[model samples]
Target: MKKFLLYFLCLISLTSCSLFPRDNTKSVKEHTGKKAEEHQITPPDDKEPNHSLLENTMELAQEGKVATSNFAVHMNSINDVKKQWGPAANTDQIGGIYYANYPAKHTVFGYNAKNILVDIRSYDEQLHQLTYPQIVKTLGKPDYLRTNQDDQIYGYKITQQFELRFIVPKNTEKVDHISLLSPNDTVATTTPPYILPIKGVSKNLSVTAWQNMQNWRNQMIQVAKNHQNFVFLNGPNKKRVALTFDDGPDLMNTPSIIETLANYHLKGNFFFIGEKVKKYPEVVQKAYTNGNLVLSHSYFHHDLSKLQAVEIKTDLAQTEEEIFEVIGKKPALLRPPYGAVNNTVITTAAQNGYKIVLWSIDTLDWSQMESSNIEYNVLKNIRNGDIILMHSDDDKVQTAKALPHIIEELTRKGFEIVDLQTLLGQKAYK
Candidate 1:
């Protein structure tokens, strides 16, 4: 009788434990106030899947690699995915890329038009949903880290094979989702050298541009040795010239100009007006990331010669802040608007930790001259250590047209094209 009573008590204890779910104190709900159920996956028919249906789906997914209801990562057939998951609740196509969303499972799958599964993603609710702190604790440091606009990402390599991405949303420290992807399909593969572009421009451009600039500088040093009377400023005594663009990072023209520079595997120095930088910050960012030097052309593009010393300082400070916000760095060089400066401008720039940069060869592209004239002016007077000035912003269509020709002519003449930082042997930014 006593043995039977003990067995009954043991059974009751087991039943009580089974009745209570393990308390996941670190669950998403505890931190974000949103229940896991609220973020439940949406079904294909634009209706919510019943709890039992979702539970069953999740159970099936848990048995797979990425936890999708039917198909798995790297799955090749669109028909197979549809046959398994029924249909996506929502589908979108952009630039020939297709994306399907299963709201009920909190999963989205992407495929090429050919229907090859490129990637699969899970949203806020997952079996191992973790905060950023917990992720770091579990995964250690990430192999790569980057920010996209506002969201931050931590990337890891698992066993040197598959890639894992942890995405932390802006303003919230908790990780919103985790993606398991093929290493080749991750951003690391797309952006080479494995480093994020400083401002969305490839770091490869920066590396190549710097190397070419240095080689040119070395050549110029030898030339200066032979000709004592040769006077060059801001560049080494070699036959290298720095290409500088000023006035604007206009929405339309700057990107094309950047592309042109990239095509030649060359770098340019962009002197951006403060207001324009505010308007077209991304263009300036691309210039910086593509291995170009970004400097200040004053905040308002006003002639520093005309502004008071205090006013000039304020203008420069404002511009510096704007540049820093975009690139996470500050300009170390300044170009007074109109190439106009007084002792006050110089003193203020010095006080503000900026070196004043002026052009050696003015292309006069700002004159809205003919493309032929702009090309002629640049190629005609170009020499070693010459800072060739051109305008990138504004409606300077002719300048844009002549840019490639100028680069080609210079390359043909054995002149190395570089930014002012390379020519002057100074840091581009602070």
Candidate 2:
């Protein structure tokens, strides 16, 4: 469990400098599900961190400030930081800027000649499972997307004098570390192409059924890559399940479904068709403001597989525009109408910055099955990381009826109901 950081400081006064590592450069154990949760923005601990602290760390990070609990007040001098986080595991200097690296705390402090803290770069694994989409949800899009060594940087100009940068290692959407720093301490960085989110199995899968689901998802990911770009069949392997409603924002069923979710204090993913969203803008806005996620299901209920690439793009763009006008942020997740997607549909969707999301459990609520049958479909076939698909269109009377019982039963079974962002660990909106 020990890691030796090689602190080799390049003396180049030209390019932007990073704590290029040596000695132990093997990537952090590719954590999945529960293990990924263990490494958070804070130092590693046996006990799970308070939810408030996680929020505070991320909230403070936006303003280029470390949390007060994590020695933000001690940045006055190197001596002050040493008193709190303890001495640095090692020290290095580059271009007269003194640096202290804390291996245990997964932090580094940079000081100018005056010996005052100027930058904080944390290589904590807490952010290891977070993808670019998840960060986009929090910080909006990065102001600058740059490539730095083996990592890509998503830089935000937090203020005129400071920048908050993300260090995403190559080939993975996970963040290796982050820096809350001054502009003077770092040089300008260049932008790169968009990075895609990764799909992984959960670490909590002990049952054979869960293991089989994990294997199926892995094979599907590979098969998807071979033909289309990518498609997310379900969420991360976890104890979480997402209840997604499609073809919604109608006057009746959508509202009833939303009401049912609210009564249970739960949030579900709603993929609204563009025409319906425009027809029921109020419904769309209400769903969004009520803490539910609204995504795209294309402009019309057309079979996208038969459409040309350009035509698909047009549909997706129009649908997103409608969603953005209603919710104020463009969606990054898409569910093709009728789940009809060929390579063209997938390729065009990727070009427009969307990941195709399909359901693992189909409740057949559209079939007008009785509430009990719909409940049976979900409760009987539910597995870890399932995205349960249901309809919220105006005519689905049975669906609205089945929702409440399903929510109550899922809670009783101890299945954590989560939003699409939490379920996929990706951006819900861009």
Candidate 3:
């Protein structure tokens, strides 16, 4: 009787275990489904991210991974960078350092000798896109701040390694311009010094030389102020003669003249016609880049003396505007068309902050004269502070041919051939 009772109890226990196994399995499956529902990544309500936002996010992700703290200083080569981040959007070289600029990412990578990456700078477009409060929220409080009254620029140093600068216009909360910089990188602060846009002039000149140049320029300006209608024909007692070419910046003869002047280590002035300047701005830019003086020869090359005051003003003003457009500054000197300035031309030019310039010696190159005659006309009549006039146009082929001989002869005679600005110790542009 005891054995039969024990077998009945064991059968009951086995039946209960089998019935509970299915319940346990169902419970485990329900828990897994709940977990999957909680963890699933759902698309945003808007569906797709804006293209710009998506691109920025991707760029940020890549930058965060590759530019881990101080990684830029450790990067070996530009090739390595290309391998890691792909090709840069734009590349430039300045002062022996290479820069890879990524506009989309708002980042710049600087590389030194052997293409070793030296610095990485990232700019936040949010400075312009977002409000000031938003920028503060995103970047946090800066470690340092600076304000410039002259330019109305506000600067914030977020860290010793990072800086933000903005151009804050007057009476506006909007930040119009933004830039990021790496304070630790010497290349970041070392910009090419603002040498006046005269090409070929060495900014590496001695301190005393620079001082003397400044003093002379100041004196000339004072003199101009005293005499309103006078044209400055020569400079101080420096054993130099200014070689000025007029009616040009034409493609045909201007380049050859520039090359010849460069070969002799001399400089010349090209008084450009405003109409021609519009057509050949690159030539004018080339002359300026080569350290040559580029001044106005009037807009239409029409004689200012013959025109009415308004007409003269219009012509001169148009020429000045065009020159400023190309070079970012207006010429301080003006040569009247055919050197025919009357009282009206003088008053108009003076009103516009231009000092009238006329030649001391005419080469007759505009007359299509022979190269020998051009050379003799210069050499025979050359003197200290003499301004010799030549031409650089299609008809002035003889002028280009005679330039080398003119420079060599002047140099041999102990005369320094200089541009009008240097000869007069005056700033070429304002």
Identify the leading candidate in terms of TM-score. Answer: 2
Best by lDDT: 2
Q: Kindly list the per-residue Cα lDDT of model 2 for residues 295-357, writing each as its tens digit.
A: 999999899999998899899999999999988999989999877766677667765667788
Task: Give the winner by TM-score: 1 or 2.
Answer: 2
Distance from true location, Cα of 93 in model 2, Å: 41
* Residue-level lDDT tens digits of model 3 in 92-150: 44443456655566556655534555445444454344333333343333333223332
Model 1 pairs whose backbones collide: 41-103, 41-104, 41-105, 42-103, 42-104, 219-238, 220-237, 220-238
Of the two candidates 1 and 3, the one with more favorable TM-score, higher being better, is: 3
The lDDT, on a scale of 0 to 1, for candidate 3 is 0.59
- lDDT head-to-head 1 vs 2, winner: 2
Q: Tell me the deviation in Å of residue 189 in model 1.
A: 51
Model 2, global lDDT:
0.68
List ranges where model 2 is wrong by over 4 Å: 1-229
Summing lDDT over every window of 10 consecutive residues in candidate 3, give the lowest-scoring window. 13-22
Ranking by TM-score: 2, 3, 1
Residue 387, candidate 3: C-alpha displacement in angstroms = 0.3
